[model samples]
Target: MKHFFIEELLPKAGGSVYRLTRMAARRALELSEGRPSLMRKPSSDKVTTIALEEIAEGRIVYNKEASSVSSKDSTSPRAVLMRGNLASSQEKASVS
Candidate 1:
Protein backbone atom coordinates (compact mmCIF):
# COMPACT_ATOMS: atom_id res chain seq x y z
CA MET A 1 0.00 0.00 0.00
CA LYS A 2 1.24 3.44 -0.91
CA HIS A 3 0.09 6.81 0.42
CA PHE A 4 1.26 10.29 -0.49
CA PHE A 5 0.15 13.67 0.78
CA ILE A 6 -2.32 15.60 -1.37
CA GLU A 7 0.36 18.21 -1.96
CA GLU A 8 2.66 15.54 -3.33
CA LEU A 9 0.02 14.20 -5.68
CA LEU A 10 -1.27 17.56 -6.85
CA PRO A 11 1.33 20.24 -7.14
CA LYS A 12 1.06 23.94 -7.90
CA ALA A 13 2.20 23.17 -11.46
CA GLY A 14 -0.66 20.69 -11.90
CA GLY A 15 0.23 17.85 -14.23
CA SER A 16 -1.15 14.39 -14.90
CA VAL A 17 -0.29 11.75 -12.30
CA TYR A 18 -1.18 8.16 -11.52
CA ARG A 19 -2.33 7.08 -8.06
CA LEU A 20 -2.67 4.04 -5.83
CA THR A 21 -5.92 2.36 -4.94
CA ARG A 22 -7.96 3.73 -2.02
CA MET A 23 -7.29 0.66 0.13
CA ALA A 24 -3.57 0.95 -0.55
CA ALA A 25 -3.60 4.66 0.26
CA ARG A 26 -5.54 4.00 3.45
CA ARG A 27 -2.98 1.42 4.60
CA ALA A 28 -0.15 3.76 3.83
CA LEU A 29 -1.77 6.60 5.77
CA GLU A 30 -2.35 4.26 8.72
CA LEU A 31 1.31 3.29 8.71
CA SER A 32 2.29 6.96 8.63
CA GLU A 33 0.15 7.74 11.74
CA GLY A 34 -2.26 9.84 9.73
CA ARG A 35 -6.06 9.52 9.68
CA PRO A 36 -7.86 9.83 6.35
CA SER A 37 -11.40 11.16 6.14
CA LEU A 38 -12.86 9.49 3.10
CA MET A 39 -15.82 10.96 1.29
CA ARG A 40 -18.93 8.84 1.02
CA LYS A 41 -20.26 8.14 -2.42
CA PRO A 42 -23.98 8.04 -3.02
CA SER A 43 -25.21 4.56 -3.80
CA SER A 44 -28.11 2.26 -3.18
CA ASP A 45 -27.68 -0.65 -0.73
CA LYS A 46 -24.59 1.01 0.71
CA VAL A 47 -24.34 2.16 4.29
CA THR A 48 -21.67 4.35 5.82
CA THR A 49 -20.98 4.04 9.54
CA ILE A 50 -18.20 5.56 11.57
CA ALA A 51 -17.05 4.43 15.00
CA LEU A 52 -16.48 7.77 16.70
CA GLU A 53 -13.89 6.25 19.02
CA GLU A 54 -11.88 5.34 15.96
CA ILE A 55 -11.08 9.04 15.67
CA ALA A 56 -9.06 10.99 18.23
CA GLU A 57 -11.05 12.08 21.27
CA GLY A 58 -12.46 15.64 21.33
CA ARG A 59 -12.03 15.95 17.57
CA ILE A 60 -15.63 15.41 16.62
CA VAL A 61 -17.55 18.40 15.22
CA TYR A 62 -21.00 18.76 13.75
CA ASN A 63 -21.92 20.31 10.40
CA LYS A 64 -25.42 20.47 9.06
CA GLU A 65 -26.40 19.43 5.58
CA ALA A 66 -27.71 22.23 3.39
CA SER A 67 -31.44 22.65 3.20
CA SER A 68 -33.44 24.71 0.71
CA VAL A 69 -34.93 27.78 2.29
CA SER A 70 -37.38 28.38 -0.53
CA SER A 71 -38.79 24.89 -0.22
CA LYS A 72 -41.54 25.88 2.20
CA ASP A 73 -42.79 22.31 2.53
CA SER A 74 -39.39 20.97 3.59
CA THR A 75 -37.53 20.53 6.89
CA SER A 76 -39.24 20.25 10.21
CA PRO A 77 -37.77 21.67 13.44
CA ARG A 78 -37.99 18.19 14.98
CA ALA A 79 -35.78 16.75 12.22
CA VAL A 80 -33.16 19.42 12.86
CA LEU A 81 -33.22 18.64 16.57
CA MET A 82 -32.78 14.94 15.85
CA ARG A 83 -29.73 15.62 13.73
CA GLY A 84 -28.20 17.67 16.52
CA ASN A 85 -28.87 14.85 18.99
CA LEU A 86 -27.25 12.33 16.69
CA ALA A 87 -24.17 14.51 16.40
CA SER A 88 -24.00 14.78 20.18
CA SER A 89 -24.21 11.01 20.49
CA GLN A 90 -21.35 10.58 18.08
CA GLU A 91 -19.24 13.08 19.96
CA LYS A 92 -19.99 11.31 23.26
CA ALA A 93 -19.04 7.98 21.75
CA SER A 94 -15.70 9.43 20.75
CA VAL A 95 -15.11 10.83 24.22
CA SER A 96 -15.88 7.51 25.86
Candidate 2:
Protein backbone atom coordinates (compact mmCIF):
# COMPACT_ATOMS: atom_id res chain seq x y z
CA MET A 1 0.00 0.00 0.00
CA LYS A 2 1.21 3.50 -0.83
CA HIS A 3 1.36 5.76 2.18
CA PHE A 4 1.16 9.56 1.84
CA PHE A 5 1.42 12.34 4.38
CA ILE A 6 -1.11 15.19 4.67
CA GLU A 7 1.71 17.63 4.14
CA GLU A 8 2.39 16.17 0.71
CA LEU A 9 -1.22 16.38 -0.42
CA LEU A 10 -2.04 19.89 0.85
CA PRO A 11 0.36 21.66 -1.52
CA LYS A 12 -1.13 19.97 -4.56
CA ALA A 13 -4.64 20.93 -3.49
CA GLY A 14 -3.83 24.66 -3.41
CA GLY A 15 -2.63 24.33 0.18
CA SER A 16 -6.17 23.87 1.45
CA VAL A 17 -6.82 20.75 3.44
CA TYR A 18 -10.60 21.21 3.19
CA ARG A 19 -10.40 21.49 -0.59
CA LEU A 20 -8.22 18.40 -0.75
CA THR A 21 -10.61 16.38 1.36
CA ARG A 22 -13.63 17.52 -0.69
CA MET A 23 -11.99 16.68 -4.00
CA ALA A 24 -10.86 13.27 -2.76
CA ALA A 25 -14.32 12.46 -1.44
CA ARG A 26 -16.08 13.39 -4.66
CA ARG A 27 -13.57 11.59 -6.85
CA ALA A 28 -13.74 8.50 -4.67
CA LEU A 29 -17.53 8.48 -5.02
CA GLU A 30 -17.19 8.66 -8.78
CA LEU A 31 -14.69 5.82 -8.74
CA SER A 32 -17.01 3.69 -6.63
CA GLU A 33 -19.68 4.31 -9.25
CA GLY A 34 -17.33 2.70 -11.83
CA ARG A 35 -15.80 5.87 -13.20
CA PRO A 36 -12.54 5.25 -15.13
CA SER A 37 -9.42 6.25 -13.24
CA LEU A 38 -6.78 8.70 -14.41
CA MET A 39 -4.00 6.51 -13.01
CA ARG A 40 -2.16 3.50 -14.38
CA LYS A 41 -2.61 0.11 -12.70
CA PRO A 42 -6.06 1.26 -11.63
CA SER A 43 -6.92 -2.30 -10.69
CA SER A 44 -4.50 -2.14 -7.80
CA ASP A 45 -5.26 1.36 -6.55
CA LYS A 46 -8.16 1.77 -4.17
CA VAL A 47 -10.72 4.46 -5.07
CA THR A 48 -9.73 6.84 -2.26
CA THR A 49 -6.06 6.31 -3.03
CA ILE A 50 -6.56 6.99 -6.73
CA ALA A 51 -8.54 10.12 -5.87
CA LEU A 52 -5.74 11.37 -3.64
CA GLU A 53 -3.10 10.61 -6.27
CA GLU A 54 -5.09 12.41 -8.94
CA ILE A 55 -5.34 15.50 -6.73
CA ALA A 56 -1.68 15.26 -5.78
CA GLU A 57 -0.64 15.00 -9.44
CA GLY A 58 -2.86 17.94 -10.47
CA ARG A 59 -4.90 15.80 -12.84
CA ILE A 60 -8.16 17.21 -11.49
CA VAL A 61 -8.74 20.94 -11.35
CA TYR A 62 -11.15 22.66 -9.02
CA ASN A 63 -13.97 24.60 -10.71
CA LYS A 64 -14.07 27.91 -8.90
CA GLU A 65 -16.53 29.50 -11.31
CA ALA A 66 -20.20 29.80 -10.48
CA SER A 67 -22.36 26.87 -11.63
CA SER A 68 -25.52 28.73 -12.53
CA VAL A 69 -26.36 29.48 -16.18
CA SER A 70 -27.69 32.96 -17.02
CA SER A 71 -30.64 33.05 -19.37
CA LYS A 72 -30.08 36.69 -20.26
CA ASP A 73 -27.63 35.71 -22.97
CA SER A 74 -30.00 34.84 -25.81
CA THR A 75 -27.14 33.98 -28.16
CA SER A 76 -25.84 31.28 -25.91
CA PRO A 77 -25.96 27.73 -27.31
CA ARG A 78 -28.23 26.56 -24.48
CA ALA A 79 -30.62 29.44 -25.10
CA VAL A 80 -30.61 28.81 -28.83
CA LEU A 81 -31.32 25.13 -28.34
CA MET A 82 -34.13 25.89 -25.91
CA ARG A 83 -35.63 28.41 -28.34
CA GLY A 84 -35.53 25.89 -31.16
CA ASN A 85 -37.32 23.29 -29.05
CA LEU A 86 -39.96 25.81 -27.96
CA ALA A 87 -40.57 26.91 -31.56
CA SER A 88 -40.97 23.34 -32.74
CA SER A 89 -43.37 22.51 -29.93
CA GLN A 90 -45.43 25.63 -30.61
CA GLU A 91 -45.56 24.75 -34.33
CA LYS A 92 -46.77 21.26 -33.51
CA ALA A 93 -49.44 22.62 -31.18
CA SER A 94 -50.74 25.00 -33.84
CA VAL A 95 -50.84 22.23 -36.41
CA SER A 96 -52.84 20.01 -34.10
The top-ranked prediction according to TM-score is 2
Give the alpha carbon lDDT tens digit for every residue of 1-96 in model 2.
777799988875567787777667777777787767766665346889887777666666553343221123334433211112446789999999
Q: How close is candidate 2 to the true structure, as a TM-score?
A: 0.58
Error of 2 at 80 (Å): 24
Model 2 has how many clashing residue pairs?
Answer: 0
Put down candidate 1 lDDT per residue, 1-96, tens digits, no spaces: 222344533331122232112222322344245333222321221111221211111112122243111112134331121122456789999999
Query: How do all models score by TM-score?
Result: 0.17, 0.58
RMSD of 1: 15.5
Give residue 10's lDDT in candidate 1 (0 to 100). Answer: 32
Model 2 accuracy (lDDT, Cα): 0.61
